[model samples]
Target chain A: MVPAADNQTRSENETKWQLGMLLSRPFFSIGRAVIRWINILGAATVFLFLALVKVFRSKQLSKIVQQLYYIGARSTTIIMLVSVFTGMVLGLQSYHALVKFGAQGAVGTLVALSLIRELGPVLTAIMITARAGSAITAEIGIQRISEQIDALHTMRIDPLRHIISPRVTAAIISFPILTTVFDLIGMIGGYISGVMLLGLNSGVYFHSIQANVEMKDISDGLIKAIVFAVIVATVCCYQGYFAHMRRDSHGAQAVGLATTSAVVISCVLILVSDYVVTSLLI
Target chain B: MNTPLIKFKDVTKSFGDRTVLERVNLEIYEGEVTTIIGLSGAGKSVLLKLIIGLLKPDEGTILLRGKPVSKMKKKEINAAFAQMSYMFQGNALFDSLTVYENIALPLLETTNLKKSEIDRRVMARIEQTELTDAVKKFPSELSGGMQKRAALARALITDPKIVLFDEPTTGQDPVRKNAILSMIAQYHRKFGFTAILVSHEIPDVYFISNRVLALYERTIVFQGTPEELEDFDHPFKDEVIHSLEALQKELTGLYSKRQFKVLNHAQMRRRAFGDTYCIAVFTLEDINSIIRYLGHDAVQEAIRRMGLYIDKHFGVIGGFSTRRNTNEIVTVLPYSDITEAENILKYFVKDFQGLEINDIWTGVRRRVAMAGPVEFTILAGIAQGQPIAEIDSVIDSAKSHQKEIWTATMRRRGEKI
Candidate 1:
């Protein structure tokens, strides 16, 4: 009976100690996390600055063109598909909502404004983050894990300049152009839905859209697209660049985790920054 | 003397709280293949990474060709790296890139070489590595050996003045290993580049290495030619040369019977060079009586614990233990002085008194109480400059004399005489 009581007390003491440890873990974890992020951000900023300074100094025009092809030209079909579907849904929903107030002519303005000013850029950024950003992270992470990045360093080739800069520049150039294509196709889809499907007046639909969307609206969205592009590319490259430094995981699992983290982080940041930029622009 | 091509002066490095290297000093001369060998997790890779500036040391300076690498500017370091090439152990071939493109990468990225020139150089390297057939294939398509050759080709494509190889022959067949070593040696000789390699292939590496550096206890413990490595009397060097099994008892981490064999071999081999070897025998007095009181398992546990303590204290200073007979253990201390042996014997008494015996059978399944303090007496015999055959006689006489003295001293004290 005494031993059992002693065992119970020992177990209670152990549980209390474990609970204390559990309570203390978050503080240390947060501190380590903060340090890790600061280091990552500092290294990433250095990489970006170094890449930008040396990006044009080296003559890799062919390589940049190759990257532009991979990032932009290959993505056009998917962007078109997503834009057309989003525009059709927006057109259908807005026509029904505006029809209730007996002002169905304003459906064109709503669809065009949403597609050109908000949905086009945000959706394009999200899609690119899902497609290209994840891929870049995995590719770079694998290179890091396989030591190709180290090999490049040994060869006296700055990996940031040779591997990352072209991809970044291509994404920056590609995003705005992709947003433009998405807006154009989305407006066509809106016109098709509002006029042919909803039996709205075609003349009013086209005129209202043209009159409502100013150059500033388009330019503002393009600027947002550029910002999102930079954020996504930088985040992906940073995650990949430092994936090997993670001691908790390695090999394919590390690369996979890095890719998922890159995509998720970039997408969330894109949405949040989209709201922030919209509020600031307005 | 001419300046060494690479020099490490009091270099120290640590990762977090773990110190990987401590005040390491080494010098690698030009046009020589120096192989560094050590146990796993002994900072062998850290030393190689330090040379290439992939890892920065916490303290001290590494000079490459009279220039301090750690203090160099980015451009300076890159320029220094341009003349140096490192072949990675895992053969870091770019998977997405074809063999030709991978080999052509340095020319494309660093050098402003023309397409024709780049192609010519790439083709030459491909031919040299015998990967012409797989020039268009990706790294994943090639076998491990082929990928290693491709990586080597890429490393050598820029014609670096210095090459660092990290385990160039690991996980390879003997034929491939020999081929790789010969290729490295031949290219090093032809190009007149200094080569530094970290490898576990000791006997094979001995043929190509002009010098060998052994890393032990986070420091460069031994640096000399292969002949010197073979002739060195240090227990750590023995562990590195002929597998750790030869130097340590696997279960106890104490010096095994192989240490005695090595001592005998070293004594015989160094006799012509006029070097003297010594042996000392230590017996745990009445250890058998204690075993009889306890059990066989407990006796084994006690010996293991005692061996661990002795190894931790004495192994660093060229002292290692092996079981001599059933109840006796002998420590063979080569190049040892009488004072050092006497000091060790004196320290052991105090150390043994303070030592605690851990309960080996305590767990959730069997809740056993911790064991009490273990007490023991030790009798020792020392023999110096004796032939391997005659050393046993000397130890026997010394053992009998020491036992008699211990008994008389205990009798005088009225203890357990």
Candidate 2:
């Protein structure tokens, strides 16, 4: 009987330990993830601080210009293509929706408001994040893995000052400009679709858009563009710079992983921060 | 004694639960070529990175001159770092930049020197390393040897006080390995800077070393001059020496004639550029009698075992051996002194007598295992400061005078003088 009691006590202890593990596992993982995020944020904050301080140097101007060419000037064709198609779709769909209620005249207001307040900035950011952002991650990740980053450090050059600052600054400057350009092309596409193709009054379309679209709406879109720029640049650079620190092997796979993660995380952060900023502004 | 240029005081480093280095203490004096020899994962590279502050040690302190690296301010550390350069094992030249740009980058980034001055320094380094033809080419366009030289040029362009090399001879062909070693040694002489080299290429690296530190099993197992390492008698040290010998030679435990060509070229290079070396040829005098008595299989086995023994014993003092025609073996011992050469001869005679041959074909070609001592004598001649082109004549001279030297040595051994 005493042995039975002892066995029962041992079984109870085992169950208690298992139960404790089950109960604590989620908390443990969450704590680990939170710590990882905190560290990433701290590194990114320091990088951003250093970048801002070094961005104004005369030597950085050429690099920033080079970045502008790579990020902005070269990206014009794709942005135009996507924005024009999106505007045409919005014009066609909103025409049908408004015409059913005999308010087809208000199609311009719907198209302009959607593009200015949301579609323009969101789509442009996604495109830039896919195009230039992944490239940045790959370039920097290769440098990190190849020991070029360490070479720079041994040379007594701050990689943050030389490599990261121009990139982040260029992204910041490029996003808002690209968004504005996208909005303008989109309006033109809307006019073409709603007036010439759909047989609506062109003057009424232009007049309604101009009358209803406020400067605040455009400003909000630009602000979102800038915020998205920060998110994408910070995420990409942070991922690339720390690529060697991860458990991934230093090869094509590691650089690919860094690029993919940078794009995914930046997209998620952009969307979430968009909501936060929109709510705060409202 | 001179003060240490760099000092590691009880340095301990670990990754997770795996300890790489445990309380390691070492010192590198100024103007000395200190080579750290170790197995692949023995934390030799990590120790180098620790000295340069690329990776910090878990515990203990590294001092540059007398200043503790960990305690220095950021600006001070950067300033201190500027005085040192590292040639990475992979020759980490920037993939995107031309060789000229890659070498010039450090000067451009760190110093306030004018472009003209930077260009002059970069060109001088390029010239020093014989990289004039590959200046505008990317690293991928250059050969492995050229890339290493380019990396070396880049490391030296800054005129650093100390240069650190990581596995400078790993993955290199014998000729290129000799060239790189000779180049580094020449530059080290030209500029009296402290050099710390980490390599797995033993005995050969000793040819260019003022001292050696052997890292084994999470700590430094031995530290001394090349001569001292030759006398070091530990199981691990023996294993390291034998492994290095095995690594350099072919399956028969003898280097090929091709490797001989490389070594001869290297010896000529050392003779041309800096140091003096001696080449000794040892011919087995009674091979026909031994073969008649023990058969062909037994003789071959004896020769193979003798190859291993010669490699182990003579290999200690940068003496590399290779088999010649059939009955002779030639070894190049990189020393200017006749005493060291004589010491090799003495040790070889003593150790060759003790080497036992076990397998034999005897009694109507039936395989029999016999453990017995073999009777043989070695006739050797020493030639010093000869070029590769002149080596054949010296070897021939050694062969023709073999009888006189043998008779004289035998008379002396018998006290018949």
Candidate 3:
């Protein structure tokens, strides 16, 4: 009341703050809902798998096993080859550095520990995500656009259980197994480079690797693999699933948007979950 | 009668509140050719998607087989998918797969059939679409018409009870469009499946579609037979009838259409040359280039061969013609208008050797006669009365301005001026 301009300014400020709250609440609510949906789907997929394992036999088991085979067995050769080269490169680099300090024997410790506890699991998770994520995303997206997903819901088939569950569980099973295989091949590579190629005694090489790394390190690698698996599979499935769910009249843009979001969300979640898993465990 | 296959009740679909289908109530029955006609974006495709479960109504329910789609379970929905197959707007054949593989996917994945039987059925479908040659070809490798046929083959692979065609004639040449439509009609006849097609193409009314549904403004504006829509006595009809009537008229008088077109072309050509007088006539009668069942490029070569000597003398240019009606076209030299006489006549050719004329379809052949100042330029001799033939007779007979001989059509005086 002291001045007309001052009163208008105060009212404008109040309106802006109120509008911000209005926008913020809905935005945060949707984001939180999406995250909760993803978690529920993840846990639900695990439960469904357990339930299916009890009831399914013979043909069903073979089908699910065949799916897992397609996901994992097909991936093993590339995973092993890449891991061996990664370890060999690490051994070579670390050997040169350690020898400068007259600690060439520590090459085993560096390669084994680094590959197992970090590169092996993370790299494997990334590769499989790229390979399988696009396939799942595109399939789910097309399904959404085509009304197959709605048809499932109408028929009392839970799309999450039938489609998402199988994919996510398959990814979860595949990644850790693939990572373990990577670790073994990576250890062999470290041995070849350190003991045979770099002239460290085979005995000292094994001893240093054993002494420096513990069960905790292997467990850390396994844990990282599990987390990365869940993140990639869940985020990708969620993105694909939600992107496909939009009932926009313009179907092409929606399908394209779904594909892009699936890849981006899977990649970001992998990175974010990587940091969280590392910080909590370390 | 049996319960309707699909029922939409007050189903309002919107994209972010911009409602496309507003409170639309419709019922689709079994084994009927329901052709939906409207302007593009009248939400015809959206309505098809809604009925097929591709989209959900924001306001109401879609009932299929007497059950609300919203309440149905997933297995039931998958079962429904078996009963219906959708041919998308672009004939969404999987470009990555061969025609055989694309058709085989749904059969192999969804049905409990042996691979051998699936192959047999897929082959049978390819043969039925007259696409036996395209079985191993990827979708992108095929021509536009062939791609649509392949998609139709895939749609039929399931032997679905209901087939949805989204714009079956959107991009095909007229001859190819008819070829696909005939195949669709054949499938409808042989299989007795419900054929609901969403299209904006003008209907071939004489063919007698069982029902025509038009989406206008935001609701089902007209629902009737093709004959009923053309009656012009209907109540509550959206006002696009005059244009529709004109299209119907053009479709019937395709002969006159081609002749008038050539006359128009001659007019434009004469204008282009400023004062250089030349008569020309052509039919938008798209021949070899488009009428592939008429024998590929062989028909075009035959037409060219008839005028090979004349083309050299006239600096003649001819290719595909602009189609107001997509039947046939003959160019007057530098054509598209109908002002010139000599240019039109000299350039006209009605009956080329080897260019077979379908009496009713290729229209009555005609010749155009135009007298030019430079040594009686006997451009083309077309037979009189028939669209292209009359113009050819005009070229042969009209030797001199004094021997104007026979002015066949009074329209030729109109054609002359």
Candidate 4:
């Protein structure tokens, strides 16, 4: 009878433990995810710092120029294509909506302000993220897996100095210029739709753009572009530079996963930081 | 004793929950080719990385010339690392860079050398590596062997005091493998740098290594000369060395000479005291002439075909074959006397002689056709022996009885001359 009683108690204890563990499992998973994200954030921050510090190293200018050609110059056509369509769509939509209020002449103010203050930087960032950001991640990931980075280390060449710094610098410089170009081209697109197609007065369109678009609006867009540049470059480079450390994959598969993650994380961060920056600036 | 150039003192390394190496202690002296051998993922590469500071040990001290690396200042650590270079297993030549640019990158990045000086150094290394014609070509454009040579040139461009080669001959054919090892040995002698190589090319690597360090079970199990390693009885020898020899046999379709001896011993142990076995040494005569007339690739093809034929004929009757050198194949027939061995050899010779040129020249036919006809002879020598102790004498006797058994010379007209 005593032995039966002990077994019953043991079963009850096991049931309680199991129930408790089941109830706490989600919390444990959440906590683990939180810790993992925090670790990644910290590592990325350190990576960015190391790369930024080496921005002025010898022969860095040449590497930076090379990256500029890849990230900024090469991205112009795609950015221009996307921006023009976006501007035209905005022009068409805003014209219809403002026409209902008998304010169709204000279309130029709306188009210029929208492109310069919001769509230009955001869309430009996203476009570059798709084009050059993915490439950088893949290149660096391949280098990491193939031990090219380790080879650099053994040669006493700091990989951050040789690889990442030039890229970060180039992106920081490129983002602003590309954003400005995106603004100009998108404004022209808006002009094409508003003045040429919709028959709004060309004079009114040009005058409204000149009068309503403030220096503050332009600067805000540039600031956003620069911030997005940092986010995109840091996240992409970090993911790829440490692709070999991924627990879920290895080798070429790890590189592919890193590239995907880099693009996804960079896009998400750009949107989140866009909101934060817009709110702070406003 | 002289101070070791690099020393790992009770070092431990781990990744998350898995410990790859624990409390590992080893010493590599200056100017010695110390090869670290182990199975895949046995921390041989981790050891090399630890020395070069590509990865640091989680615990314990790594001393360079008696100075603990972990205790050194940042600048001092950099200074120590600057004296070393690594040749990665994959060659790791920058895919975007041309051969000249790849080899020149180290000098351009690390040193403040003038452009002309860098060009001169790069050109010299390119010529030395026999990559002069490939100067403008990217790594992807170069062949595997050429890429390895480019990587070696880059590693040696700095004239580093210490060099680490991580499986330098991993994915190479037997000829290229030996060529790379010989190149490493030659450069080691010329540069007199401390070299730590991670490899599984047993016996081959042993021939070039001054000190052999065997890593097994996360720690170095043996450290001694290659001769000492042969006599040193350990699980590492049985597991890693013997298994790699087995892999070597699979890759080349022939046993190494050491593996042949091991098999001979095992066969003798299985047999009665007075049981007679036969040793036949088949030599591909006038190998230099064949090489000269038909090119190196054709010669290699012929040898490979010969090995395949030997296996096909002798392997059925429990006979094993090994390539004694570049031109000779030694077959050991267990429980067979001279008469049986001769009979088998006659059949093999006749079959081999009647083989179409297409059979032996499948891959190299175009090259062979361009080079025209070449005459080559197969010579076979046989001797019977009872005692395992007299196996060497038996082999010597077999070599002495070598006589031409078959000859073939192909003409462009599809007729044998």
Q: Which stretches of candidate 4 lie over 4 Å from their true place?
A: A1-25, B246-417
lDDT of 3 by residue, B1-417 (tens): 679788888899998759899988777788888887766778998988787776778998888878888899988976776688788777766555688887776675566788799989988777666676777888778988777777777778877899888888778654455556655765687789998998644544224257888777788877767657655354424354445535543433222333334454465444533333233333323232222232222222223232332333334443222222122223333332234444344333333212322221122122111122111111222222222334444433322222221112212211221
lDDT of 2 by residue, A151-187 (tens): 7877777788788999999999999999998998888
lDDT of 1 by residue, A110-134 (tens): 9888988999999998888888788
lDDT of 4 at A66: 96
Angstrom error of the Cα, residue B35, model 1: value is 0.9
Off by over 4 Å in 3: A1-106, A127-170, A188-199, A210-220, A240-268, A275-282, B1-3, B65-81, B205-208, B233-417
Off by over 4 Å in 1: A1-43, B71-76, B244-417
Query: In terms of DockQ, which candidate is strongest?
Result: 4
Ranking of predictions according to lDDT:
4, 2, 1, 3
Chain A TM-score per model, please list them.
0.89, 0.95, 0.75, 0.97
How many clashes show up in model 1? 0
- The ten-residue window of minimal lDDT in model 2 chain A covers A244-253
Question: In candidate 4, which residue pairs clash?
Answer: none
**Comparing candidate 1 with candidate 2, which one achieves the higher DockQ?**
2
Report the TM-score measured on chain A for model 1. 0.89
Local distance difference test scores for all models = 0.76, 0.79, 0.63, 0.86
Give candidate 2 regions above 4 Å deviation.
Answer: A1-17, A248-250, B250-417
The candidate that wins on TM-score is: 4
Tens digit per residue, CA lDDT, model 2, B149-223: 899999898888899999877776554564577567767877988899997655456667899998888888788
lDDT, candidate 4, A20-80, per-residue tens: 9999999999999999999989989999999999997788988999999999999999999
Q: iRMS values in order, in angstroms? A: 1.1, 1.1, 6.4, 0.8
* Per-prediction tally of clashes: 0, 0, 71, 0
